[model samples]
Every structure is written in structure tokens, then in C-alpha cells.
Target: MPRIELKTKIRAKKEIVFDLARSIDLHKISTEHTDEQAVDGKTSGLIGAGEWVTWRAKHLGVYQNLTSRITEFKRPDFFADEMVKGAFKHFRHEHHFAEVDGKTLMTDFFDYTSPFGLLGVLADRLFLKNYMKGLLVKRNDTIKEFAESERWKEVLSS
Candidate 1:
């Protein structure tokens, strides 16, 4: 199993940051490689626990479909989502938020295992690990930008 954990502070209210953190729309905007469409559930508006969204996107130029379910949620604080169906052998990600000096401290924790057993482990070491990290870095950088941008103000009000 591989675990990736990342934390960063965003200058915004916890609720605002947390909401944007889970927004599929924001995700599509942030991840340049992902073209996501919400299906089988609320595509827009607020998302909460028990909601499920299906998305199709291009990852590494390969189109993939994934369905994720919100397994746990506490508004403005934390949420957890697990891949119901996807490419990976196992994938579960948790998002956490906290307030600090009027800023939001956001954390992402992901756990996954590769499909090919020892071969998968070796493959991860050779490419997937760094690739995944770079992917996450890109995602977080976009998140930081969005959280600090004027657009997020509109997010705050809504």
C-alpha cells in the first residue's frame, strides 16, 4: 500500500475552503488533465455525505471513468470518499479542514494499493510514485490559487 499525505493553508474560511475542496467543478478547473462530468447524483450545488458522483476524465491521455461515494462528511470540517469503481486496486481519500488564524488548514490523505502485486510495487517505485506526487502537487497548487482568488469570494457567498 502507498500512502500520500499533503497539507497546506488557504486564506479563507473553513467552510469556504472545505466546500471548494470537495467540489467536482473546482476539481475539473484545478486539474488540467481531468475532464470530469458529475453523473448519477447532484452534479452541481452543494455535496454532502451519502452523495455519489460518477466522472469520466483523461488521465495521462487515457480516458477513465470513476465513481466515488462520500462515505463520511461533517460540514466545514472533514470528509472522506472512497472509490467505488475505478482503475486502481484500492483507493480511499480523506479530506480534512481546520481553522487557524482565519485561514483554513486543509489536509489530504490517500491510501491505495497497486494491482499487480510485487510488479505493481516495482512500477510504483519506478514511475507512479513520482507521477502521483507531481499530480497531487499540481492539484494543490491550483487549489491554493483558487482559494486565494477573487472567484472564491463568490464561492464563499454561495
Candidate 2:
């Protein structure tokens, strides 16, 4: 298994940042490469533990459909999503948020295992690891921008 962690500071409320990260619409916006939506779930509302969402998107030049459920949810603090079905042998992503001087410290923890054995390891070493990390970094930057945008302002104001 490979683990990738990224941290960023955002000038937003912890809850606000958390909500944005969990929003399927925001996720689609952040990761523009993937066309995804929350079918049979809240598309724009808060999601809690035990909640799940089904998403369809393209990966590795192939169309993939996956269902991931929220295994852990701590309001304004942390949440974890585990894949119910997907390409990887295992996929789990945890999002954490902490308030520092009224700003939010956001951390992302990604753990995954490729499907094939030694070939998977070699592929990760050759390209997948860096590719995945780069994707996460892009998502983080987009989230930072969206979290600080006027939409977040309206959400926080209300």
C-alpha cells in the first residue's frame, strides 16, 4: 500500500472548509478531469458517518463507477471515505481540519493499493504514485480557491 499526505492552510472556517471538501459538486469542480455526481445522496449538503455516495468517472482512460461510504465523520474536524468498489485493491481517504487563529488547517491522507501484485508495485514506482500525488495537489489547490470564494462566503454568512 502507498500513503500520501498533503497539508494546506485555508483562510476559512473549519466547518466551511470541511463541507466544501465533502460536497460532490465541489469535488467535480475541483477535479475537473473527472465528471462525478452524488447519485442517491445529497449532492450539495453535509454528509455524515454511514452515509455513502455513488460516483461515475473516468480513470486511467477507462470509465469507472464506484461507491464510497463515509466511515468516519467528526463535524468541523475530520472525515474518512472508504471505497466499496473500485479499481484499487483498497482505497481510503481521510480529510482533517483544524482551526488555527480563525483559519483552517486542512490535511489529506490517502491510502491505496493497486490491484495487481508486483506489477502494481512497479507501476506505482514508475508513474502511478506521482500521478496520484499530483492529482491530490491539484485538488487541494482548487479546494483552497473554492473555499475562499464568495460561494463559501454566502454559506458561512448564513
Candidate with best lDDT: 2
TM-score of each: 0.88, 0.89
lDDT tens digits, residues 1-158, model 2?
99999999999878778888877666777666766555565455556789887777776787787788899988878999999887889999999999988889999999999989999999999999998899888888877887887676543343
The total number of steric clashes, by the backbone 3 Å criterion, in model 2 comes to 0
Q: Write the per-residue lDDT of candidate 1 for residues 1-158, one digit (tens) a residue.
A: 88889988988778778878777667667664666667567576566799888777777679888788899998878999988888889888898998878888989898888788899999888888777777777777777787888776554455
lDDT of 2 at 15: 76
RMSD of 1: 1.9
Predicted structure 2: lDDT: 0.82
RMSD of each: 1.9, 2.2
- Number of the top TM-score candidate: 2
- In model 2, the clashing pairs are none
